[model samples]
Target: MSEAVTHSVPSASTSPGLLASLDPLLREWLPRQRWFAGKGRPVTGFSLVSATEVLPLNSGLGLLHLLVRAHQPLVPTQSAPAYPADCYQLLLGVRETLPPRLAPALIGHPTQGPLAGLTVYEALHDPRPADVLLEALRERAHLGELRFERDMAQEIRSDLVPRLVTAEQSNSSLVYGDTFILKLLRRIVPGINPDLELPLALARAGCARVPAPAGWILADLPADSLGPGQGDPGDPYVLGVLQPFLQGASDGWDLALREMAKGEDFSGAARALGRATAEVHTALARALPEVTMGRAQMEVLAEGMTERLTAAVQTVPSLLPYAPGLRSAFDALADLAGEGQTWTAQRIHGDLHLGQCLRSPSGSWSLIDFEGEPSKPLAERRLPQPTARDVAGMLRSFDYAAHSLRAEGTQVSAVSGWADACRAAYCSGYAEAGGRDPRTDPVLLRAYETDKAIYEVVYEARHRPDWLPVPMAAVRRLALPEPS
Candidate 1:
């Protein structure tokens, strides 16, 4: 737990009419953001959940923190279910006129709000406001409902330079002098986020495969705002996380692609990554409680997978043909459970893929990002799941890397062989490190892989139609009988 101290608060300036005046501008700007989730749906309106004046606008440089709810029309399909309004976190910089250097961060000048006639841009893009956020974390400042806390054991410098990372999809990241990277979650959910919780737990367990959380920001919300039975009063939402940035580390996805393009073997790196993943899993098991999943739990899991497949087929008609074969994989796992087979369930990385890994210059591998599937509910993402789920996700990632660079309608035998070799090597490494081979449980592994493939199919169909064929190929393979 981090120590917190109250800081001098700014005068309240965010009134109910503030969001109403900014509504028109936000509706246009919010959808254009890369981190915005509701891309297809039109933003109907905005509701201000909470707003704080981080710095007074009387100064030339002002910072305002906002938590606003975006209302959109529900697009319910068999595959995609209806969801409630989404809350977003915004850090806005106020200036009388925009500077040429900060033109790209411009969110447009609001003509109707308290901030009318002032240019409001992304604060993270500016070094001054970004530094303010880091300083708050270093000081453990509690400004109103927003609290910035840091690991007492870790020392944070006051003079690191801040630069906003541009490639992020769901969240915004600011790298501070290659020493620390702060991930500010764009979507706001009122609960303990696994991204912060798991990393802190791994650090406590002395897991070197994951970066330790040096500091974090949280927002306290009313219990009633969280809805009934969601959480107790005073459960703070994880707003951002600060972690040590591994200098000279390469993304696993980029590394794999480079190796594949050169026709060089990536099995050794893949094997090392598998070992690192197993180490993280081992540490997570040690830090968190484990449970034995019984027949009832197995049935529930299988049923959920089946339902997802049903929905996917409804939305992506291409999946209709392979539905039966995919459903069989889930059925096999349920059958094994019916026969009294059980597996240990613990907190595993919910969304494990090559993109979530980093390879240091020294050739050591480290896993990053434990946020799980961003589309899932916070409670579900925090649930204990079978380790095979993560293994399946990585396995699919290997396959994706193999096909990612291939041309359309090209023969897949060579790339498929490469993916197969990497997969086998990874599983072998995991067995050597974790003492359990994922391949030993064929039924369970196949079920998880199939479920992951189904999820890929749905995601690709919705987001990247061109990439749909990649997961569709896996769906075709998983739907077939396993080699005897």
Candidate 2:
């Protein structure tokens, strides 16, 4: 079984009535869904930018393309790295969206509000979506339940069968075994995917921080094969990949709570996770030896920031106060770039978040998923990124864990303290494992944190307007003072 999503409405040329259009599916329901970025606020309105229907499509398996314009600030971090929120399309479905459309945010119920009236649900737990999707992709799409279950925990040496947690993706579904998760792919790629590619290499080298390859399923995609004009109209993307399911696995955020909860701090785990991260990075680098990243990469980051800064300032005029200060910071970071390459770069996990990591039953940490995300194109996601890119992402994950606990309704002061401890623990671990002291150079940490936070702020504003303040909170977390 593949991780599939289902919903009451799907967008296609022959879609259902008002409740079936992409707009109605997520109209007043944006503020209620967990996956929905903005909850609590009634939607002003939403518009469909574009929607493509899945070919050879079936009824129960209604596949379509959809881009929505909702009333909220766009988030840069939670989204694709490029083209910050002018307009974007997210493959979505129904089952992922709660029936009531009114559910609590991770931490805030009344305050955080519901998924109703938000945007859309990307995936679902119901099997309907997954069943239909898999059938279609396998060219045998149908409406039926999978009667495959085993009593014991599985190592999942084969393909994954994650549940249809929701239906909202470009080519992915949420599948779960008794002890592993398998994200099934809908689209197929001719070459290999970096997500599964790097982790397997690391695992083969006996790396531990990452989840070892359980098994993988290969499919054909004559449609998306390389070169222009040589693709199939009816081809489903890569089918999917499978991995060991973690039982009650705590994420970086959850681990943060345990650390703070015991007052022992997560320093131990951070160090361990850091060492594991380092090893994984080292192994990955071996597979990608041509990392000649230099100022050229910095130029890309700077240019992207420049464009986003412009867009953000326009959408969230309140950002005006920090605009000049932000620009100055960008310049300072850019100044550090050297004409000659100073650091190695490689194709890495483009979309890394707290959700990407898990705490094992043995109290060890394991990472998952190399595919950055569905929103990003595979080519861009596989681009060589600075080691700092991964480092910054890890740092952000630490912060996200701590802060997300607060969002889960932890007392602000308490979660804040835990967050601090977790942050320290993670950094300490990274330093001990990475064998580098970035925190010592407060300026360096500040620059990196700002860049990360800028991304978070934009991403939250667009995805979770209510949570936008969370990233904004990092504004003060930076070592830099408000510019005069």
Candidate 3:
């Protein structure tokens, strides 16, 4: 979390209007927020897309729902390649005075706007607003274009207390009485959100490897005739999704770390997880469209990998030394394509890692977080890719676990043996579970793994400098002996 700093509250607007006090407050507060995508970039301007008072604004306590476009230009000039705008959802709670408990959630006090002298803060930080949001969904209430909906067959109790899930990074999740979990997407994008679409499809396919979807909240925006597929019903942007909360479940990342701490072998658990992953892949293949990409497509895929590597090298100069060898891995893929190699492309968990999975008390794995890479464009993430990409993600995760321990001042060589054992066991289990063994295609697997490592290099450099060695070590191994 960023250190708390005092900020000058925005001056209030002269007009007496709803949301009149928000512009200045958000300008100062949004950049400091963890969920804000444009953290390092300057927020040049803001445009209010929509604002509705879910709870009467005039009331002493207020709940205002806002959709604001944050305009962040790469260069503060008109000649730049169009301004990049990200629409964000803001749920604001207004009170006459800040309570002792809610002090941490304060955005700031507006001195001149409509909310002048009132304490304004993030509503999700308070249970009252969380409960209000859930109850509205239970009752299927509609406030303008924002629709709060739920599955009629699933009964939701209004009295169920809501508690925010704190471990999340990209999105916010709230658990209600341990029965249901609602995930609110802070960054809003137009079109179908795969997080919602994939789960619905998996449930319909009768896949038990995923938690059942209970309900969802969405925003139906006015049609943009200029947009592609303007008449499509999926024009509505998904705001949040509700699903059953796993009561006795532990995240796979934590489970692996715990096993490592005990010096116990995780091969058995890794094998089971591999099988579960295959099951979900098979179910997704049955539920969605599948296509075969020939040599030409494989070349395109290889080129994309090379492009990402080149981009990462520019950002993380440490990658410069290994760029050639990394490019050779991609070149290997292209060479295979030249030999007429073909692969299957289908809907996959674009971003799959240990943390994205959960292990139930029964020892079964449940996949979650189907939103894909939050930084990637939605259309690109939606495109079908090799299932091996998901396998590579998990494979890299094992390596990450090993390196994480080393970073924690517990340097040991034993983690390598454990990770290798888990990787082999996982591949064997995947083969047994009716999926092709990733090890069988070493070139493809290596290429994908290399790509994933390069991505991690850039990510670690930007986020955790201390963690850069984790991926840098992988980069060194990927590079060859270099004419020894």
**Whole-model Cα lDDT of every candidate shown, in order:** 0.88, 0.53, 0.82
* Residue range 1-484, candidate 1, lDDT tens digits: 4566786666645565678767887999999999888888889988777788888876889988998889888776542322367889999999999999999899888787578889989899999999999999998998877998889888899989999999999999999999999999998788889999999999999999999999999988886453345566777789999999999999999999878777788899988988998999999999999999989999999999999898888889989989999999999999999999999999999999999999999999999999988877788899999999999999999998887767354444456588999999999999989999899999999999999999888888878998888898899999998787
| lDDT (tens digit, per residue) of candidate 2 on 372-484 | 75555556677776555666677777777666666666654455455556556666776776676546544334555667777778778766887876776666455255344
Error of 1 at 220 (Å): 1.6
TM, every model: 0.96, 0.63, 0.91
- The parts of candidate 3 lying over 4 Å away from their true place are 1-20, 75-83, 224-234, 411-413, 481-484
Query: Candidate 1 has what TM-score?
Result: 0.96
Q: Pull out the clashing pairs in model 3.
A: 12-112, 12-113, 13-113
Worst 10 residues of 3 by lDDT: 1-10
Task: Compute the lDDT for candidate 2.
Answer: 0.53
Which residue runs does candidate 1 get wrong by more than 4 Å? Answer: 1-5, 77-83, 226-230, 408-416
- How well does candidate 3 score on lDDT at residue 478? 76
